[model samples]
Target chain A: MPLGDETIVLSRRQAEIGFAILAGLAGFVILFGAMEHDTGWSRSGPEAGYFPFRLGMLLMAASGVILLRVLLQRGPSEPFLSWGAAKKLLAFLLPLIGFVLLIGPVGLYLAGAAYLFVAIGLIGRVPWLKSGLIAVLVPVFLFIAFEYAFKAPLPKGPLGPLFGLI
Target chain B: MVENFTQLMQGFAVSLSAYHIALMMAGVMFGLVVGVMPGLGAPNGVSLLLPLTFTMEPVSAVILLTSMYWGALIGGSTTSILFNIPGEPSSIATTFDGYPMAKRGEATKALTFAFLSSGFGALFGVVVVTLLASSITKFALLFSPVEYFLVFVLAFASFIAFGAGSPLKTIVSILIGLALASVGMDTISGSMRLTYDIPELIRGISFLVVVIGLFGLGELLETMQNPYAAKAVTTRLDWAEVFRSAMIWPRHYASLLRSAIIGCWMGIAPGGPTAASFMSYGIGKRMSRNGANFGKGEPDGLVSAETADQAAGSAAMLPMLALGLPSSATAAVLLGGLLIWGITPGPTLFREKPEFVWGLISSMYLANVVAVIMALATVPLFARMMQVPFSITGPIIAMICVIGAWTVAGAPFDLWLLMVFGVVGFVMKALDYPLAPLVLGMVLGDRMEDAFRQSMLLSGGKFSAFLGSPLAVVISSLIALCILVAVMGAVRRRA
Candidate 1:
């Protein structure tokens, strides 16, 4: 994961502009949502949306300024993400997404083990034996720590009843 | 003051138990591990451990967390001196002189100076907190909703003025946080504000979940993009040399005092430890007699930075306790923890939970000593721990983040929120948007809104309600001044 010379994937200028636009759009959505309820003062006090409505307006204003500044900027923009960096980030992130999604169906322990096995063995290129050991040991440790020691339950999913841990 | 002292003594009685002492030691050790790790910081470490504290008493929980904070601060400097990698952000300045000194075969001297000075700084900070705690709380007790709202304004305004980064970006970051906080239910009106009719949004967004995502997974992703090898400088600590280095503490008294004052001021003012350390380092370089030797390897440079960093880290706790305003991200998380534990921070907390307050304050005194000793004793152990490949630690950390998120409210939705915020955190970091303001915003959003709405109701929706009282007038003026200074500074920079 050490940085090396690589071609640009996203330029800083583009990122700035894109994110600002997205934020501005988010601001509009928030403002529109605020309008669903009264955004002004009522007989009791300020309405639920009063503070958020102002926040939404401020967000749009701030983001609009950012967008304008980036759009008008001159000279070279640095690379926001190089190709190699993006690839590396995705390699880690995609699996993380998979792990989170898997948690719903398989529970935390199994999902965690599966994620670690793939992450350490396949992506990290560690030897299978060590990766498998960590993959198994970590979830077991977490199960004990969370369940028995802390008395807090994690999502144990379908196999929970078999282990009687849920 | 006498009453405070009496309460403090009673607090000592509560915290001196074998069980509490053991928790302090365990916390420091765990914090050291977190601090010595690059991607895992004090805030993230504390939040990750928060779920476990649910079953513990508030006093015991606080002792553990605060001790961990002390350990992490000390642990961060270890990697700075040993590996030229700051385990925590605040220790970045330590590397300026700490690494160079270590490279010159004075590893023992550097570590000793860092540990001793940091210990002194933390002690000084805790003492300040102890002395000022009563007065500040008493003053805070007089605050009306107008003043409280102004306090929140002042906090954000100070960030724009004193914080490093674009003020607009800071504002945007804060707005995003406030918006996120407003999601789910409006506590005041009992209406849904920003949930977009989603069932998950009804519970409101938990700041803890966001914190885990931003600092935990976001930092991990950032590290993946630009990884560095951790090659530690191997050095055995000699007790005689350490004793000899400790002998020269008096020579740098001026630097220590100056840095400690700067650190305390920054901590209280919301500049935070990272900024305080950097500022102290810059000022030390200019003021010290050995100024030219700063980067190459100056003991004073390392001392000043480490002292200020730790001093600020401890002093930031004062405002969180007294004013219910968190000056740093870690403090904000601790404040959240306090909230979850059913202890509301403020002047009322002091009046209501004297045992909890004093116990925590007393623990600070004990914890720093324990942190310094533990840090010195376990350097080799942590140094070995650092060698564990990131490939293994990375996935383990991600798993911790997932587990942390799931446990916060046990909602599957929070896991997804964690992922979303993780990406947002990464982008915010890359874009140079200060994340502290956002965290602070999330922590204080509801409170600030409550204050504002209450004030409005008090004044029948009149805007002048904010300026009604003299105290409010003064705080409002300060907030205005802060924004003005920021705007002027921005204009001058552009010019």
Candidate 2:
């Protein structure tokens, strides 16, 4: 018998099962590490590895329950991960990478402005002129507030001499 | 009695200083601004501004910073009332009734009630911290590593009970957090454990960075990911109407007192403000003439929430100052600040640093008055702060987050770690894992381990060491009960 026209959903249960397996593997790694570090019982007290060993057991136990549940579940088919969300996340990530790369070479002030201008433009789509004004003005203001007024040192670059004028 | 009086009087000596008072006022104003802003929070604000206090006298510096703490507490309600968005976690309950009232044009009434109730709650908490400081510290010192481990266990278990999704995911997230926490130094061996050959990872990760990435960057990413989005909600106020309505009815003093009690009590508990505010709001609804209007933006609802929220913020301080154990994130920052100042809080703090202790208390009273005036005056203006476009504001926040992270150790390595944690934070958020436990674990994990090792040594490795005294026995039993309850609750909820 044909079922009603319902969209097929991805097996959310399967992904959960996958996670359980991964967790079990990680648990073993942790267990191995603790055992290697001398976690055996002693006459007077628990040894150096006692707590971590217990935590590893707890992890394994929880993961076992999760894995069992995941295997027992009957579910529909659907995508486990969403591609659409990843794209949006990447937009921010790219600019963050750029900021990191530029910070040392261009200096904190200029690099900060560049990051701000680009990030704000990408996220808000504000006009370039407005974004530029904000990008340049905000960091400079911070420079004056933190570096000049408070005497807290910031990263110096080629423009370090220029900032000294403040 | 005379000693107590002299100590308090000496505290006033610092608190009553014109300079100290002025600094407190400034802190309150700054806290207000940060609290009302959607993305900014008390910890971020404190960390950002803490550097400025270096040159100020310690008393004045504390006065200012703590006032900012109070200011942020009150300022959070402003946005929660005007917009449904809570500026701080403590104000989440305020949005339930406060926003509904604002939507109906009772913005002024809501704001006014929120302001006054917060003032009352804070003053009440001040009295409690003042009187109960000694006893609380005495109680805290009795907590051994095993007891603290149990407390941490109970706290971590809560994620399974309170978090919205599958317990498996929450545990995974917690493990990840614990793993991350372990990346720095091996306490016993005095060796770098998981630095991955990076000199920066040797210091571990920064809490500020982790939180900012998790809360700020993750949120921004989530908002951008939403395909269908309307323009950000912005509101304009009719100042005259707001003021008129705000003054229409006298406040319920009894309700304020009740909420204050609720705040102080809940602040001491594990749930903190979220529970305190809800409990106060519930009580207000049950005991009000406007009971039927609870969710429709009644002014009384606003007052109930405001009183309890601020009171919780202040009461949360008791554990931090009295016990040297921070009950919440903001309290953690204050604790860290105290450590940096070479001041060890807890039972001995009263005897060793009476000036610091009393000075903090006296400043609270002054900060309350300062914050109230500042909030009332600034509410209308701060409401318009969103006018600053995201391009400008967003980057500024990120910059602050970066700077704040770097300042923790003054290392660029921490900055890199911050970026990584930010990404991890984003993923954890998407997976419905709570970040608080991870943070609590990171903060307390080493201490818990150290205490366990020390107790073992003391007992000559006897397991019975944990159950030696009646106090230890009772605390240990309670911890066992907590775990059993937590596990049972999870199973029931799943069923």
Candidate 3:
């Protein structure tokens, strides 16, 4: 997408537009869905849909006010997302994607260690040995602390029982 | 009250255990480290450790978490004073003057004052927790679901007033957060809202994941964007320079006492550290002719702001522990931890588990002393941590975020949800929405629904029951007033 103007600091109108659409969608979804489920203030004391229906009304009301505010606003233009900023954001985000993809295939400890090492090295650029040591040690410690010591069951992958080796 | 004292003495006996004292010390140390690290606030630290609390007895868990909170609050001030970086939202105001003072070659003095003040402030909060816990819980427990929801709504409305320039965007960001909160299973019915055929969304989103993304990952991204920002370098670290003995007792008596009172008041009111610190600092500044030198390495200014923040941070626990009312986001997360531990907060806790309550309170005394010593002793080390390039911490925080998200549900789908929330958080940040309220709303949303249902059911579905109780009426009115202020601010802006 081509970049918008960069000089503006606040973009109220754009925000309102986005919120309005979201609110309308949320309202419609809840209203129709709840009505279908027979949401009413009848015998079962305010039916299943009663609270949700009210919530939908709130969503619509808040969004409507937001939409009106945005439409009325006028000021310096804003670049919603700049390429430089996006790239910087992506630097952190892409690794996040990798970490997520790695989570299930590898258990939390191993995956967490890998994620930690890669992230630390990527940001700090410490000596490889130091970074590696930290990465391996942190997750191991956490696993021992939470999983073993605290008895909180963290995810264990195919190497599940093998994790006991650590 | 006398009985409360006897119970407190009993609590001291339980807290005096070497193992429990050691845990408090460890919690303080860990909390300080987490707080010193940019982007990981008290709430994130407490929530991340929530799983660990499972193995602990309730008293130990509460001690660990509360002490950790104390540590984190104090820890945040270290970054603000040393590196011009506030570790959390509460510390933001601290940097306005704190950094300026550090640059003027009084880093040691500034740090010392902060440490002392924070300790004093926390002690103040503890006193309130001990004295007023029963009464406070009774008052807060009377609030109905409608009142509680409106409190969320009203607290959210304050953002519009505060974020006046982009009120529309702020409201939008809040709605986005609310909508995101709605994605998981419906609290009233077992039905899902926006799961969209994914089982991961069935559990909804983890508040920790979103916080990690916002504070840790978002900070990493932000730091990278401003990579060329001026670096902080300090050369001097003399023991005598850091601690002035002659002024110690006099400064201590005045600064500590004033900051503690300010912290307790601010903590009870839910104004948070930002307000508490600034208020204390302002009072300190006004009291002394140090006004001109306040931000320029004035030892007292640093002490007042830093101390008040810690005090308020500790005092904030009063509401959470006693009333089940969280005065800040960190307390809210602690609330989550309390719920997870199967311990219901509020007045019943005292009657049901006095030992647990007393032990936790006694642990506070140990944690505060330990935290002050550890924080001051490790000053140089933490300062060096600031030198760790953003490039490395950036990726590492990202990794932690993933682990944290996955840990929340052990599902791959949550990883995606984490990203979605991260984007939403970033957008919210850009649009000027306060993320805390969103987290609070989501955390409390399910409970609010239940409270509403229960209250109605009890009253035979009489709508007026929400306001029938005097306590409920008072709270509901306050909530209404807050919303009125927010709506009025929005309307005036439009006009």
Best-matching candidate per TM-score: 1
Please state the error at residue B207 of candidate 2 in Å. Answer: 2.6
Expressed as tens digits, the lDDT of each residue in A1-166 for candidate 1 is: 6556487868999889888998999899899889888998789899988888898899999999999999888999988998888889999999999999999899989999999999999999999999999999999999888888888989888988977934
| Sequence-dependent TM-score of model 1 | 0.98
lDDT of 3 by residue, B1-495 (tens): 787789889999999888888888889887987888765667777766766566678788888888888788888878887778777656765776677767867677667667776777777778877787667666656555555544554455554544333555555445545555566676666766555556666777766667656655555555665663325646345578656832573555676677778878877766667678778888988885566777666666776777678777777777666656666678777887788778887666778888987788777877898888888888878877777776666565566566666556566766676677667666656665566666666566666666666667767888787577675677667766765776687578658
lDDT of 1: 0.90
* lDDT tens digits by residue: candidate 2, B164-277: 446666676667556555556667765554454666677766565666666556555554554322122335545686567556544577677778898898676555566678
Candidate 2 per-residue lDDT over residues A1-166, each given as its tens digit: 4333232232355556665777677666666556645576566355656656666676787788878876776766454345555555676778876887777777777888888888886565888888888888988888887786777777867888876775
- Candidates 2 and 3 compared: the better one by DockQ is 3
- Leading candidate by lDDT: 1
Please list the residue runs of candidate 2 whose C-alpha ends up more than 4 Å from where it truly belongs after superposition. Answer: A1-36, A40-84, B1-6, B50-62, B141-179, B226-251, B286-289
Candidate 1 has which clashing residue pairs, if any?
B184-B201
Q: List the lowest-lDDT window of 10 residues for candidate 2 chain B.
A: B225-234
Candidate 3 residues lying further than 4 Å off, grouped into runs, are A1-36, A108-166, B137-197, B227-230, B252-258, B282-288, B491-495
* Candidate 3 chain A least-lDDT 10 residues: A4-13
Hey, what RMSD does candidate 3 come out at? Answer: 3.9
**For residues A1-166, could you state the per-residue lDDT of candidate 3 as single tens digits?**
4654343333445654774776567766755545544466655456556666666666677667766756776776555655565666676677667766776787777777777677667545677898898888887777777676666667777778787776
The candidates' interface RMSDs, in order, read 0.9, 3.5, 3.9
**TM-score of every model versus the real structure:** 0.98, 0.87, 0.87
* Model 3 chain B: ten consecutive residues of lowest lDDT: B159-168
